[model samples]
Structures are given as structure tokens and as C-alpha cells.
Target: MACLSRHRHHHHHHHHHRAWLTSPDPDMLHHRPLSAHHRPLPHDDALPPLLRTPHPPRLRHGRHRPHPRPQFDGPDPIWDAVRQEAKREVVQFNSLCASVASIAFLVFHFNCVQAEKEPILSSFLYASILAHDCLEQALVFVLANRLQNPTLLATQLLDIFSNVVLHHKPIQRSIRLDVQAFKDRDPACLSYCSALLYMKGFHALQVYRIAHALWHQGRKVLALALQSRVSEVFGVDIHPAAKIGEGILLDHGTGVVIGETAIVGNRVSLLHGVTLGGTGKEIGDRHPKVGEGALIGASATILGNITIGEGAMIAAGSLVLKDVPPHSIAAGIPAKVICGLQEHDPSLTMKHDATKDFFTHVATNFRDEMPNG
Candidate 1:
């Protein structure tokens, strides 16, 4: 027993040390408000003659214009997942304790009597369950990387376990550094974060993570099969071929769909009854393409070959039939650009700003239309 505990401690520290030595600090990357639903900006979803790709901030005259990032520190999602996993860990620990105690007591009291029969299987089963959770945690990391190939922070999980009932003993030196470099997105997007947490509550959402890891490991069929099971259990369908990114939450998640060819970026969120489906009989590249930081609202239907750009918001009950630009809000039966995704004034989110922008655009065009008035 002592030997096993000692081995576990050594294994933990080794991982931490290696990750730090190899990977750069994740904090160095710009941290943004990584929720699916951030406030909209001033723009329309439909293409404007002047519109271009919404690139990150550029070097102004050889000086770096910082990426539009969050102003403060935020809660880490990986740590949050760890906190969640830890609750399971505690239950496992209790089971382990109980089984061990029961077995010990039986042996002490009925020494040769029970020793002559079959050994206890309950403890072994419970111990396997506990081991399953640990395996789940490790497998989740692989899935995240599969969904989005980028610099993923490994430390947020370290902090979560640190505060929980179990810590991966002594801790790995590199993982500690990974935690130290961990940059969690701002929690101001908690509504989205909360939704993702809710999705995790579903039966084996972590299965996708494992499948994702498997796909990367050259086991495509097995990966898709696992995803198929995840869809059956969770009612949330994500295509293994579809490229996804970091910090995304599939909230409420029932009937949430992703097409076989859909592309999703980091920190995006999709709510219940959301569809990323096709419009025609077209086969290859027929589905919609969604950009980074985009939000697809509840029961919204986005059909055909379209680009819903970065930071765009598709309001609830809307039918998106065309391309929607970055930083715009598309709502209504056949959704058009009602407003941009980044709306500054709180009073303007509800139909008011769209009206104001409409008049503002009209007033600016009045001179070209009518010389008087």
C-alpha cells in the first residue's frame, strides 16, 4: 500500500515538471471574454461593401496593437471541470474507504473462515469506478485538443484539484507551471459558462473528448462510434470531423446539432434546439461555417452555405438563410441583421438600437437622396 502511494506521488510530480519545461506560458496568449453570448457591436450581419475579415489587432506602424482582450483575471474552465470531477472523486474515496474497512474487518474477525472462500469483488468494482473518473479526466484533455488544435492550458485543472478533496499527490512540476501560466477567460460570460457546465452534467459528455483523442490517434471509426453513443445518450450531436475550439459550451444541449462539415472556433456557445444544418441537396461543403466567438441562440435554424462571422449573434426563434457578418445580431422569422453583436448601450439591445442605427444610416444618406430636408 505504501509503495503504491509512493509511486502515485512520483508520477504526479513528473508530469508537472515536463509540461512546464516544454510548453510556453498560456497566460501569454490574449484572454478575451470567452462566452458564447457577449454583447453585440455596431454593425450589420449582411455584407457591407467595406467589410473584411475580422482579424485580431495588427501591428500599428511596427508597434503591437494589443488584441482586444478582457481587462481582468477570470475563472478557469479546466479547474471548474476538475472541481466537478473531484466531487466524483470524493464519492470514490468514500467507497474505497468503506470497502477496505469492510474487508479488513472481515479478515480480522473471521480470519481463516472467509479467506478460504472467494475474495471481495465489491471493493474492486468501486475502485474501478474511481479509476474510471481519473481516466475520464485525462481523456478529456485529449478531446479538447482534438476539437481545437491550439495552445491549451493544462493548469486550470491543477488548481481545481488542489482545492478539491483529492490532489494528484505532490503534483507534476510542468503541470504546476501549466497552471501558473493558465489564463482563464473572463467570467463575465458566466451565462455561457454555466450552460457548458450544464452540458457536462449529461451522461458521458466526456466521451466525445475520448473519441476526439482517438481520432487524432488514427482510430477514426472508433472515435465516430463513441461520438455516436454520446449523441444517443446526450441528444447533443457533434461531428468528429467538424473542427471545434476551446472553452465552448453546449448549454441545455438537447437537440443541439452540428453538421458534418461545420467549423466552430474558440469560446463559442450553442444553446438548445440550435441547428447547423444544410439548405439544399449539395453534398460537399454544403453546411454553414461559423466563426469565432459566435453565439447561436435557442431553436434558431441556420441553413445553407453561409458564414456567420466572429462575435455574431443569432437571436432565438430566428431563421438564418444567408451569410451573417461579424459583430451583428440577426433575428426575426427570416433573420436579417437587426443589430451588431457588440452593442455598448444596455438600453439598445431590444430593438431600440436597430431603429436608431436605421435612422442614423438614413440621415447620413439623406443628402444623396434629397438635396433639401
Candidate 2:
């Protein structure tokens, strides 16, 4: 995975490298007509025309004459050529146009591969650059009509979703961290791109992000509609009202349910079939509040307003009702604190049957390897 720092560095380098293009040197001007001396104006012709001021301020007869400039009565070939070149450069650099061109290249590559021809690395590289938002765009397209507006175009849908979720800086940062969480925590996740594109858990979480934002903005109807689409598509039901922190992994997301008023903390891992629901008939704030770095195992049902403390680990198939202390392991029906974990964050380690301390295990292995002394 490429770090954001590296991307910023590259972007900075690109701007610095092209710094000269923004300010032309007076000794190399060639695009326009020569001055009063009939000698070419001092300017750098190598500078791209887009950055070069179209009408450069020139000194004529020792006076700054703004008008009576080199007038092209007809289409001057030199000016026309510069204008065409600038248009081509602008189109090439436009991100949206690049993305569209990338899609075409990807389709061509797919066809070539299907025909048993060799895949092109150059094509794949080009596609990867512009297709970073492909998954997000696809998600928007999938839920475009969820609001029941049949006349909305795909581009409009993209803009709507981008404004609500994708374009927000905080949401974008959360998504990158979410993808990193999937890559680091899930053994099956091959790469950052794989997590971004293929993981339904990731997809479900991102949709919830969009819904969560809309919900706060008082678009309750649209938020609920998105919630419905998420449940139908991903089998993971998280209420728009639920509060979830970043770096969360809803592993094997099928059948995972997080109810309204539920609070899941940062770096928490919830396995498949886990439920954070209410104890029943209570009106306000009934769902469980899971702490940061907590690991809830498969089929674990945590109910009420109980706190699964930070770094707590709940064993698989457990029924948790009471509050579980931090760094403790809870298990069995109506789960109890069976033991404590030496590992600081069980969510990071994902060790289910860790009875002894992690260091104890390491020391035991070391002892076994040593000769009798």
C-alpha cells in the first residue's frame, strides 16, 4: 500500500518541477510576433502555452502599450497551434477524462486477456492511477435509484454521493484507514485495492458512512433508504443512528447486526454473526457500547447498555449480558470472565484460545529449545 505521505511528496515534486512553466523567462519568447526591433521577444518557448500569459505585457518605444497588441486579423497559425496544443494538454491532465480513458483501456485489456493474449502492465498501471474511485463510483451507481428518483442520471448520482460522503476530507481519511484495517487484520485480504473493491464488509461500512452523514444532516428518509439497500445487498445491518469509530473490521460481514444507539470504538473487530442489540422494551440508549480495541468473536450476542471494556476479548459463541472488564476474556452462555489476556489489544492479535500469557508461551518455547542445565 502506498502511504499518503509519499503521494503528497510526489505531488509536491511535480509542482516544483513545473515551476518554470508558470513564469516565463523574458529571453525566450517565440509564440508571438517580434517586438519593434523585429527580434524575437526574450522568453522561453519551451514553456507550455497554458501557463504562458496569452497576451504578455510588452514594452514598445519605451512605453507600456496595453492595446495595439499583435492583432491576428484572421486565425494566426502560430496562435491557433498554441491554442490546440493547450487544449490537448488540459484534456490529458483532467482527472475525470483520465478516469474515462482508463476505463476504456481496462475494457480493451480484459478483451485481450479473454482472447489468450498477454496482459499489458502499462495499461494496468494507467488504470490504477485514475480508477482509485472506481469502487466508490460503482457503489453510487448501485444505489442511484434507492431514493426512487427515476429521472436522475448517473453523473448526477455520482455528484450527490461525492458531496454527501466521498468528497468530505474526514470521511475520505476514515475510508483509507478502513481499507488499511481490512488489509492488516484479514488474512484473506490480498491487498489494499482488493479490500477497497471486493470486500462486502468494506462496501457495507462505506455505505453506512454515507447514510450516517445524511442522517445527521436531517435527511432521515434517504438515510433509512440507504440502510435498507445495505441490508439487502451485504447482509450486514448497521443502523444509520449507530456510532462507529475508525479502523473497524466487520470480518466475514454476513449476519452481523449493529442496532440503533450502539457505539463501537476504534480498532474494534467484530466477527461474523455478532450482534450488538437491545435487551428489549427499553426506549432510549439500550444497545451495547463496545470499547476501543475490543474483539467480539463469531456468534457473540452482547445486549443492553453494557460496556465491553477496551482491549477485551469475547470468545466465539458467547452470550454476553454483563459488562466485561478491559483485557479480560469472556466466554460460554451468559458469558463470564474466564481469564485475562496478556496481549494489550486482542483485536490486533485475533487469538481466540489464548489461555496463558503471550510471553509465557514464548518462554515455554525457549525452555523447550534449551539443553538441561
TM-score, one value per model: 0.48, 0.60
- Judged by whole-model lDDT over C-alpha atoms, candidate 2 comes out at 0.61
For every candidate, C-alpha RMSD to the true structure in Å: 20.4, 17.7
Model 1 regions lying over 4 Å from their true place: 1-198, 201-206, 212-218, 343-373
In model 1, how large is the Cα lDDT of residue 138?
31
Which lDDT tens digits does candidate 2 get at residues 1-373?
Answer: 1111101111111111111112222211223443343322123233333222232122222332222212112222222222222223333443333332322211012233332342233223222222122233334433442322444443344445756654554554456557667877899875554554468888788888888998999999978877887788689899999999887888989999999999999889999999999988988999999998899999999999999999999878789999999989987677889787788878877777663454355568989999998
Report the CA-based lDDT of candidate 1 relative to the real structure.
0.45
**Candidate 2 wrong stretches, greater than 4 Å:** 1-129, 132-157, 355-373
Total backbone clashes of model 2? 8
The window of 10 residues in a row where model 1 has the poorest summed lDDT is: 1-10
- Across 259-302, the per-residue lDDT of candidate 1 in tens digits comes to 77888765566667888888777889877888766777779888
TM-score of candidate 2 on Cα atoms, chains taken together: 0.60
